[model samples]
Target: MPWFPEFSSAAELARREIRIAGQADPVAQYFTALNEGRTDALEVVWPGEVVIHDPRAGVVRGHRELRTFVQDNRSWLAEHEARIEIMASTVVGPRAVVELLAHVRYDGREVPWPMAVVAESPDDRSVVFRTYCSQWPVDGRRHVRPPVFEPGHAEPGDVVGRHLGALASGDTESILKTFVPDGYVAEPIGPDYIHRGADELRSFYTGTFSEGGGIGLQNCTMIDDGVRCALEYNLIAWGTHAVPPQAGIAVYERSPDGLLAAVRIYDDVEPPDSR
Candidate 1:
């Protein structure tokens, strides 16, 4: 079976109970609120608190802010005539990550924007949404996103863990050994930077580890379902240099042979040289 299945539509916002038919994802209510410009449904889904970490809107909390945020987004989407399409969905534990492709008419052209949203339910009442995407599709530059969550002890295991561990070790041979021959790295900015195959992966990692050390990420949360491991982290250091903390999330997909198939990253963190 495929790791990422389509987020089922069988579940309804009005139904709070999780059924064998589908998982009771609060994200459904989130989109519904945005579309209808109403927070009542959202309040029903998550009665206690709704915290959103949005690239454009920053951090939104509580009912009042959520309502305003929803209304504003609804207006913006209506103005831009945005159409969001779900690409894939991965559910693990209490967190569900949904990848979406949104198209908006801009400068007389419809631009495709890719995004991933992590919906984490800590308990039965509260939920947090961390939206990972590049604003470059709309505005031609990367926005520097600051840290959202403090570092925690949520480390990944298995092949996904091996990849991240190799990354921090700055071992090119070790990292390359973890990926399948045809594995690729998909950049967060857009699809234009997909580095595939052994040679391309080697080149990408070589430049990445050139600063004398490997990329260091502090684990904040991890959601793994034995196939795709979704890790939310704070990039604390790159190479020997201790850089400013930046928030990011990555999904590591495992091939059938227990090797990495692909690594999809989502972040707006520009390295020191870029800035």
Candidate 2:
């Protein structure tokens, strides 16, 4: 069995103890098919509700709309079977958050994405509504968060200095260990995009560091408003295969543990002018 990480909260731990009961029942089978693309099974859960947030296509709501959404991609899901595994689950109050590993296979190729589902029900027995999900990556640099780190925990300048120090040493882990799980990051590059979670975030760093160039930060500043702190810094990219380092401004939101829950990067590092 693949090792699924556990949670520190006892409430979360208790939820994990619930026996999945037995082998997947008909209802479970229906959900599996619905997720895997056999829209035929969707009717089983229909009359209830369904909403899909497609990163590329945007948000889709209702079973009829969902059916249209799925039918529109029948050729896609039909090509493969996607497996969804629950990695970690926690139930608090009437809400249960489940972290999942969704393995997607298409034309014999597989891509795994991590997703979070927040299910809320009047009773703790069955799920009525669920929202939120994303493709998974190994690093956490891709996500950013709103500035929410409480002040007094650490000076913004100190936080900025620490980030720069991490870059100077190429200590990727320490740098990322500073952010919260739902953290956000806004990239500076033209295809401007927002990244959330640690896995995709790591990919951002891997790409930056793998460029065979030494990177550094400058002109860093920090600002906090009770809930989170934003660490703003300039990124210098230059080295072998060295193009001039584009100067970037980064903002980070810190968690209670001092990890970042959000980050934003803005800059213009255009290629050197060629005569």
Each prediction's TM-score versus the true structure: 0.86, 0.35
Q: Write candidate 2's Cα lDDT for 201-267 as tens digits.
A: 7776656555453464444333344343433333444323434323233445456776666654443
CA deviation > 4 Å runs, candidate 1: 1-23
Angstrom error of the Cα, residue 224, model 2: value is 24
Q: Listing every candidate in turn, what is its Cα RMSD in Å to the true structure after a full C-alpha superposition?
A: 7.8, 14.6
* 157 Cα displacement, candidate 1 (Å): 1.9
lDDT scores in order:
0.83, 0.46
Alpha-carbon deviation at 162 in model 1, angstroms: 1.6
Query: Among all windows of ten consecutive residues in candidate 2, which has the lowest summed lDDT?
Result: 143-152
Candidate 1 local lDDT, 75-133, one digit each (tens): 98888889888876789777899877788887778888888898888887788988988
